[model samples]
Target: MSDSDEKPEHQKENGEINGEEEIRLKPFQPWYSVQIKGASKNGEVVMFQITTVKLEQCKEEVEVDRQYEDFEWLQHCLNIVPNVKGVIFPPLPDRPIVSAAEAEAKSRKQLGTASKNIKGDEFHKDCRKLEKYLQGIVRHEAIGKCEALSNFLTKKEPPVRAKLKKGILSNLSRAVDGVRKGGHKDIDEMFQKERDLANDMQKIAKETSLNFDTMVNSLCRISMACNHLSTALCLGMSAEDNGASAIINKLQVEFAKSIDHYGYAVDVCTANDENTLGFHLDLYSRYWLSCKEMLFERTCALVQFDNASKTLEKAKPLKKPMAEAAKEDAEKELNAISEVAKKEITKFHQQRTLDFQKSLILYAEAKVKAARDVYALLAKDVSTIKQMDVEFD
Candidate 1:
């Protein structure tokens, strides 16, 4: 009956009785199920069919098949939105850098067989990665609400892309020069140091990833060599008593089993390192670089504010028409923008610090576990060798 109890006219369609705007804030809930239908050859290119299903009430449950290139284009378009400027878009899975002929040759050498299709373990891995990336985009607060994302999911055509303009708040060259004259020194130095550190960390991650690949290859080769030797020993022996052959066979089986188990453990460890350490580092590298850019923008804003303040002061004594009034208004607006920029700088620094520390701890723990696993596997192998009554020099 009272004014407070009456609903706004805008809320009537939704059956709301609240006096205020009656905004219906829904919980963040969205679901998409991805299925890799199959692989097909299209002319000279090999493509995989990916089906995406949207599960929501009153929303169309659509199924659309897409190729690998389509997913790449979707990511490229989604990343251009201005509203999601500071957010780090998920990186797509690395496409095979090698030529198809080279890849086929390598596959044949490693597998000891001819390649039949392009859908191998790597294809499955990439599919999982693409699914995760899509899930992340739909769940993000800023990116999820963008109409472009929905279009990418449901439409046959690519989403329209918008490119954000560059420069420090669209300032003129002279204005930017004037602003930089009053730039803060301490903040610049701090951000620069952080940027350098992030670059170094990324380089380290890349080199370490290569090292892990080498280690895995060596392990697999050693395992295969052991298996080959075991088979040879089993075939060469023709004993009348069967005593020597039986002991040799048992030792060979134990050795092969131990090596195989160790190889599996190493493979798992390599994957964990790549997913945890490599993924985190790559993501944070982009995030921190963005933070550093924000800091630069904040610095420019502060400089601009200070420059305008000085101009306003100088114009007070000038016998000019509307000059002083214009400077006064400019100073006020720049002051407001500078305040927001400063707040952003502080927020980004604090948040990234906390996130990086937590992620580093997790990565270290994973590395320690990997080391212990290798050690345990080797120890078990040594014990098995000793139990076989075999003498080693």
Candidate 2:
């Protein structure tokens, strides 16, 4: 059809004057728009623009009708809306969260371990100190016995004095030999030897009123001191090693029971989250709990050892007198016996004390190593938890 024939009646008046039809355009509306400055995995930035919708709803519903044909190279400048609320990312595995109960259990284990170690260390130290004190007592007793024998020899009349002196010397020699052998079967035997040496000295001291009285008094004093020291040392040793060990063992047993409780808690938490996560959280909880239990047990052992040592220290001073008395009559036959007993006690203390100290030192070293290992594992677990949180966020 011809252009004139197609013209409507509205333009008929202008048709004779070569009239043309006019087109109408709508008014632009102000709208909220976001200019994205950065690109996210799931969302993109809009360089510039205004739209007639809320940014919140526009992200999901806004549409672009105009094509940028003239500015083809600027296509990247056009703002695009994302369908999702946040940046799109790959799904991550759900990480197990450490629960309050699990944390508490672990802490308890760690605390127990630390306490045990401290106790053990203290016990060992005390034991060593006791041993040292006992050794001193033994040496003092030996010296006293020698002096007592010399005094007895001086008091005796020529032939008798010589015979008594030889007897005293022979006894002293035997006592010394016994000590050097370090093979006494019983503590009583050792004490009996000391008593014998004291009696010999007392006998000689009784021969002359003035000198004998003085010697008797000295022998009594030394004997009393040695007896007191021995008693104290024995008490201390028993308390430190035996008593402390018993207490630690009990505590450790309790700690082990706690582990079972922790395990149960973990199992519950794991079951609760198992369906959602695809893996068992109880496994991690149980593993960590096991570590804590081990640490607790070791600590208990350490404490027991420490307590034992402390007990020994407490006993050391108590037995000082007995040790001293044994030394005073070292020269007397009876004094020689006391010296032998004192020496044996001292030797026992030294060996045991040394052993305790060594054990504590080794335990501390192992504890530190284990702690470090645990820390590394905990760090890894925590990192995994963080990553999971980020994914959800």
Query: Top TM-score: which candidate number?
Result: 1
Q: TM-score of model 1 relative to the true fold? A: 0.55
**lDDT (Cα, tens digit) per residue for candidate 1, span 283-316:** 5555554444544544465455666656666664
Candidate 2 Cα RMSD (Å): 47.2
**Ten-residue segment with the worst summed lDDT in candidate 1?**
111-120
What is the C-alpha lDDT profile of model 2 across 1-393, one tens digit per residue?
Answer: 777776775476776455233322332222223221221121221111112223335543232221112112111111121211111111111111134444454433433433222111112222222222222222332221232322221222211211113378888975675454323232345443533443353343233333423433343344334444444444443234345555544444343333333333333332222222211122222222322222222223333444444555555687756544443432243233334434444553464356546544654565465456545654654554444322211
Model 2 residue 226 CA deviation (Å) reads 52
lDDT, model 2: 0.33
Candidate 2: regions farther than 4 A off: 1-336, 389-393
